[model samples]
Target: MSVIYGLLTISILVALVFLIVFIFSVKSGQYDDSYTPSVRMLFDDELVKDDSKKSSTQEQKQD
Candidate 1:
Protein backbone atom coordinates (compact mmCIF):
# COMPACT_ATOMS: atom_id res chain seq x y z
CA MET A 1 0.00 0.00 0.00
CA SER A 2 0.99 3.59 -0.42
CA VAL A 3 1.11 4.12 3.34
CA ILE A 4 3.59 1.28 3.71
CA TYR A 5 5.77 2.75 0.99
CA GLY A 6 5.69 6.17 2.62
CA LEU A 7 6.64 4.73 6.00
CA LEU A 8 9.51 2.77 4.48
CA THR A 9 10.77 5.81 2.64
CA ILE A 10 10.70 7.94 5.80
CA SER A 11 12.49 5.30 7.82
CA ILE A 12 15.17 4.91 5.19
CA LEU A 13 15.71 8.66 5.03
CA VAL A 14 16.05 8.93 8.80
CA ALA A 15 18.54 6.05 8.87
CA LEU A 16 20.57 7.56 6.05
CA VAL A 17 20.75 10.87 7.86
CA PHE A 18 21.94 9.22 11.03
CA LEU A 19 24.55 7.24 9.08
CA ILE A 20 25.88 10.38 7.46
CA VAL A 21 26.14 12.12 10.83
CA PHE A 22 27.98 9.13 12.32
CA ILE A 23 30.46 9.11 9.46
CA PHE A 24 31.09 12.81 9.87
CA SER A 25 31.66 12.43 13.61
CA VAL A 26 34.15 9.60 13.06
CA LYS A 27 36.04 11.63 10.50
CA SER A 28 36.15 14.60 12.87
CA GLY A 29 37.72 12.61 15.75
CA GLN A 30 34.61 12.78 17.91
CA TYR A 31 35.08 9.20 19.08
CA ASP A 32 38.86 9.21 19.44
CA ASP A 33 39.06 9.94 23.18
CA SER A 34 36.67 7.24 24.35
CA TYR A 35 38.29 6.67 27.74
CA THR A 36 41.00 9.24 28.38
CA PRO A 37 38.55 12.02 29.26
CA SER A 38 36.81 10.05 31.97
CA VAL A 39 40.12 9.16 33.62
CA ARG A 40 41.47 12.66 33.16
CA MET A 41 38.58 14.16 35.13
CA LEU A 42 39.25 11.83 38.06
CA PHE A 43 42.85 13.05 38.43
CA ASP A 44 43.64 15.96 40.73
CA ASP A 45 44.66 19.45 39.52
CA GLU A 46 46.62 20.26 42.68
CA LEU A 47 49.94 19.41 41.04
CA VAL A 48 49.47 22.16 38.49
CA LYS A 49 49.04 24.91 41.04
CA ASP A 50 51.79 23.44 43.19
CA ASP A 51 54.21 23.43 40.28
CA SER A 52 53.40 27.06 39.49
CA LYS A 53 53.92 28.10 43.09
CA LYS A 54 57.17 26.20 43.33
CA SER A 55 58.48 27.86 40.22
CA SER A 56 57.61 31.30 41.52
CA THR A 57 59.25 30.57 44.88
CA GLN A 58 62.38 29.35 43.12
CA GLU A 59 62.44 32.49 41.01
CA GLN A 60 62.11 34.62 44.10
CA LYS A 61 64.87 32.67 45.81
CA GLN A 62 67.12 33.11 42.76
CA ASP A 63 66.52 36.88 42.77
Candidate 2:
Protein backbone atom coordinates (compact mmCIF):
# COMPACT_ATOMS: atom_id res chain seq x y z
CA MET A 1 0.00 0.00 0.00
CA SER A 2 1.01 3.63 -0.41
CA VAL A 3 0.78 4.16 3.32
CA ILE A 4 3.29 1.39 3.93
CA TYR A 5 5.72 3.00 1.52
CA GLY A 6 5.38 6.35 3.25
CA LEU A 7 5.94 4.84 6.66
CA LEU A 8 9.01 2.98 5.47
CA THR A 9 10.49 6.14 3.95
CA ILE A 10 9.87 8.11 7.16
CA SER A 11 11.43 5.41 9.29
CA ILE A 12 14.52 5.26 7.12
CA LEU A 13 14.93 9.03 7.24
CA VAL A 14 14.64 9.03 11.03
CA ALA A 15 17.19 6.22 11.30
CA LEU A 16 19.64 8.09 9.04
CA VAL A 17 19.32 11.22 11.15
CA PHE A 18 20.07 9.30 14.29
CA LEU A 19 23.06 7.68 12.62
CA ILE A 20 24.47 11.04 11.62
CA VAL A 21 24.03 12.43 15.12
CA PHE A 22 25.73 9.41 16.63
CA ILE A 23 28.64 9.72 14.22
CA PHE A 24 29.04 13.38 14.99
CA SER A 25 29.01 12.73 18.71
CA VAL A 26 31.66 10.05 18.39
CA LYS A 27 33.93 12.30 16.35
CA SER A 28 33.50 15.07 18.95
CA GLY A 29 34.80 12.99 21.85
CA GLN A 30 31.41 12.18 23.31
CA TYR A 31 32.42 8.56 23.81
CA ASP A 32 36.09 9.16 24.54
CA ASP A 33 35.66 8.87 28.29
CA SER A 34 33.60 5.72 28.25
CA TYR A 35 35.46 4.22 31.16
CA THR A 36 35.15 7.23 33.42
CA PRO A 37 31.35 7.15 33.61
CA SER A 38 31.25 3.51 34.55
CA VAL A 39 33.71 4.10 37.38
CA ARG A 40 32.58 7.59 38.31
CA MET A 41 30.28 6.40 41.08
CA LEU A 42 33.23 4.76 42.81
CA PHE A 43 34.88 8.15 43.02
CA ASP A 44 31.85 10.23 43.92
CA ASP A 45 32.94 10.48 47.56
CA GLU A 46 36.36 11.67 46.52
CA LEU A 47 34.76 14.44 44.50
CA VAL A 48 33.27 15.83 47.74
CA LYS A 49 36.34 15.64 49.90
CA ASP A 50 36.23 19.37 50.54
CA ASP A 51 32.70 19.10 51.83
CA SER A 52 33.74 16.42 54.28
CA LYS A 53 36.57 18.61 55.45
CA LYS A 54 34.17 21.47 56.00
CA SER A 55 31.87 19.21 58.05
CA SER A 56 34.76 18.01 60.14
CA THR A 57 35.82 21.56 60.86
CA GLN A 58 32.27 22.44 61.83
CA GLU A 59 32.13 19.47 64.18
CA GLN A 60 35.37 20.55 65.83
CA LYS A 61 33.97 24.04 66.37
CA GLN A 62 30.83 22.53 67.94
CA ASP A 63 32.88 20.54 70.44
Candidate 3:
Protein backbone atom coordinates (compact mmCIF):
# COMPACT_ATOMS: atom_id res chain seq x y z
CA MET A 1 0.00 0.00 0.00
CA SER A 2 2.76 2.45 0.90
CA VAL A 3 4.68 1.46 -2.20
CA ILE A 4 1.65 2.11 -4.34
CA TYR A 5 1.17 5.53 -2.74
CA GLY A 6 4.81 6.39 -3.35
CA LEU A 7 4.60 5.32 -6.96
CA LEU A 8 1.42 7.31 -7.49
CA THR A 9 3.03 10.41 -6.02
CA ILE A 10 6.15 10.05 -8.17
CA SER A 11 4.10 9.51 -11.32
CA ILE A 12 1.95 12.55 -10.61
CA LEU A 13 5.04 14.69 -10.00
CA VAL A 14 6.63 13.50 -13.22
CA ALA A 15 3.45 14.21 -15.16
CA LEU A 16 3.19 17.70 -13.68
CA VAL A 17 6.80 18.42 -14.58
CA PHE A 18 6.20 17.30 -18.14
CA LEU A 19 3.08 19.42 -18.41
CA ILE A 20 4.92 22.46 -17.10
CA VAL A 21 7.72 21.96 -19.59
CA PHE A 22 5.26 21.61 -22.44
CA ILE A 23 3.49 24.82 -21.45
CA PHE A 24 6.76 26.66 -21.17
CA SER A 25 7.84 25.44 -24.56
CA VAL A 26 4.56 26.57 -26.09
CA LYS A 27 4.80 29.99 -24.46
CA SER A 28 8.31 30.35 -25.87
CA GLY A 29 7.11 29.39 -29.36
CA GLN A 30 9.41 26.39 -29.44
CA TYR A 31 6.80 24.55 -31.53
CA ASP A 32 5.66 27.47 -33.66
CA ASP A 33 5.74 27.01 -37.47
CA SER A 34 7.99 29.83 -38.57
CA TYR A 35 9.32 28.11 -41.67
CA THR A 36 6.50 25.79 -42.66
CA PRO A 37 4.03 28.57 -43.56
CA SER A 38 6.47 30.40 -45.83
CA VAL A 39 7.62 27.17 -47.47
CA ARG A 40 4.10 25.81 -47.76
CA MET A 41 2.89 28.98 -49.44
CA LEU A 42 5.74 28.84 -51.90
CA PHE A 43 4.97 25.25 -52.92
CA ASP A 44 1.19 25.10 -52.57
CA ASP A 45 -0.26 23.80 -55.81
CA GLU A 46 -3.89 24.84 -55.32
CA LEU A 47 -3.05 28.46 -54.59
CA VAL A 48 -0.80 28.69 -57.61
CA LYS A 49 -3.50 27.25 -59.89
CA ASP A 50 -6.20 29.47 -58.43
CA ASP A 51 -4.09 32.61 -58.90
CA SER A 52 -3.34 31.72 -62.52
CA LYS A 53 -6.99 31.01 -63.23
CA LYS A 54 -8.10 34.30 -61.73
CA SER A 55 -5.65 36.32 -63.80
CA SER A 56 -6.43 34.41 -66.98
CA THR A 57 -10.16 34.93 -66.51
CA GLN A 58 -9.57 38.62 -65.88
CA GLU A 59 -7.57 38.94 -69.09
CA GLN A 60 -10.23 37.09 -71.06
CA LYS A 61 -12.94 39.34 -69.59
CA GLN A 62 -10.94 42.42 -70.60
CA ASP A 63 -10.75 41.15 -74.17
Candidate 4:
Protein backbone atom coordinates (compact mmCIF):
# COMPACT_ATOMS: atom_id res chain seq x y z
CA MET A 1 0.00 0.00 0.00
CA SER A 2 2.80 2.38 0.88
CA VAL A 3 4.64 1.45 -2.31
CA ILE A 4 1.57 2.16 -4.40
CA TYR A 5 1.14 5.49 -2.68
CA GLY A 6 4.76 6.37 -3.38
CA LEU A 7 4.33 5.39 -7.04
CA LEU A 8 1.21 7.51 -7.31
CA THR A 9 3.02 10.47 -5.87
CA ILE A 10 5.87 10.02 -8.30
CA SER A 11 3.52 9.73 -11.25
CA ILE A 12 1.70 12.91 -10.23
CA LEU A 13 4.99 14.76 -10.01
CA VAL A 14 6.04 13.49 -13.43
CA ALA A 15 2.71 14.53 -14.91
CA LEU A 16 3.03 17.98 -13.41
CA VAL A 17 6.54 18.36 -14.79
CA PHE A 18 5.44 17.33 -18.25
CA LEU A 19 2.47 19.70 -18.08
CA ILE A 20 4.73 22.58 -17.19
CA VAL A 21 7.16 21.73 -19.99
CA PHE A 22 4.35 21.50 -22.50
CA ILE A 23 2.92 24.85 -21.44
CA PHE A 24 6.34 26.47 -21.69
CA SER A 25 6.95 24.99 -25.10
CA VAL A 26 3.56 26.18 -26.35
CA LYS A 27 4.34 29.68 -25.15
CA SER A 28 7.71 29.52 -26.96
CA GLY A 29 6.11 28.98 -30.40
CA GLN A 30 7.20 25.37 -30.63
CA TYR A 31 3.75 24.42 -31.88
CA ASP A 32 3.30 27.44 -34.18
CA ASP A 33 3.95 25.77 -37.53
CA SER A 34 0.75 23.78 -37.99
CA TYR A 35 1.07 23.29 -41.72
CA THR A 36 4.77 22.73 -42.36
CA PRO A 37 5.04 19.42 -40.55
CA SER A 38 1.99 18.03 -42.29
CA VAL A 39 3.21 19.22 -45.69
CA ARG A 40 6.76 18.03 -45.09
CA MET A 41 5.60 14.56 -44.16
CA LEU A 42 3.51 14.43 -47.31
CA PHE A 43 6.63 15.00 -49.45
CA ASP A 44 8.97 12.49 -47.83
CA ASP A 45 11.40 10.10 -49.57
CA GLU A 46 9.22 6.99 -49.96
CA LEU A 47 6.74 8.70 -52.28
CA VAL A 48 9.55 9.71 -54.64
CA LYS A 49 10.85 6.16 -54.80
CA ASP A 50 7.38 4.76 -55.39
CA ASP A 51 6.77 7.30 -58.17
CA SER A 52 10.04 6.46 -59.92
CA LYS A 53 9.31 2.73 -59.75
CA LYS A 54 5.85 3.33 -61.18
CA SER A 55 7.16 5.42 -64.07
CA SER A 56 9.92 2.94 -64.84
CA THR A 57 7.43 0.08 -64.94
CA GLN A 58 5.20 2.10 -67.22
CA GLU A 59 8.13 2.79 -69.61
CA GLN A 60 9.14 -0.86 -69.66
CA LYS A 61 5.59 -1.91 -70.52
CA GLN A 62 5.47 0.64 -73.28
CA ASP A 63 8.76 -0.61 -74.70
Taking all chains together, each candidate's TM-score versus the true structure is 0.53, 0.53, 0.67, 0.53
lDDT of 1: 0.92
Tell me the tens digit of each residue's lDDT in model 4 across 1-63.
999999999999999999999999999999898888888887798899999999999999999
Residue 56 in candidate 2 has what lDDT? Answer: 97
Instruction: Report the lDDT of model 4 for residue 12.
Output: 100
Ranking by lDDT: 3, 4, 2, 1
Tell me the spans in candidate 2 whose CA falls farther than 4 Å from its real position.
34-63
The C-alpha local distance difference test score for the whole of candidate 4 amounts to 0.95
lDDT for each residue of candidate 3 in 10-49, tens digit (9 for 90 to 100): 9999999999999999999999988888899777998889
Total backbone collisions for each predicted model: 0, 0, 0, 0
Model 2 scores worst on lDDT over the 10 consecutive residues at 29-38
lDDT (C-alpha, whole model) for all candidates: 0.92, 0.94, 0.96, 0.95
Residue ranges of candidate 4 with Cα displaced over 4 Å:
34-63
Candidate 1 root-mean-square deviation in Å:
9.4
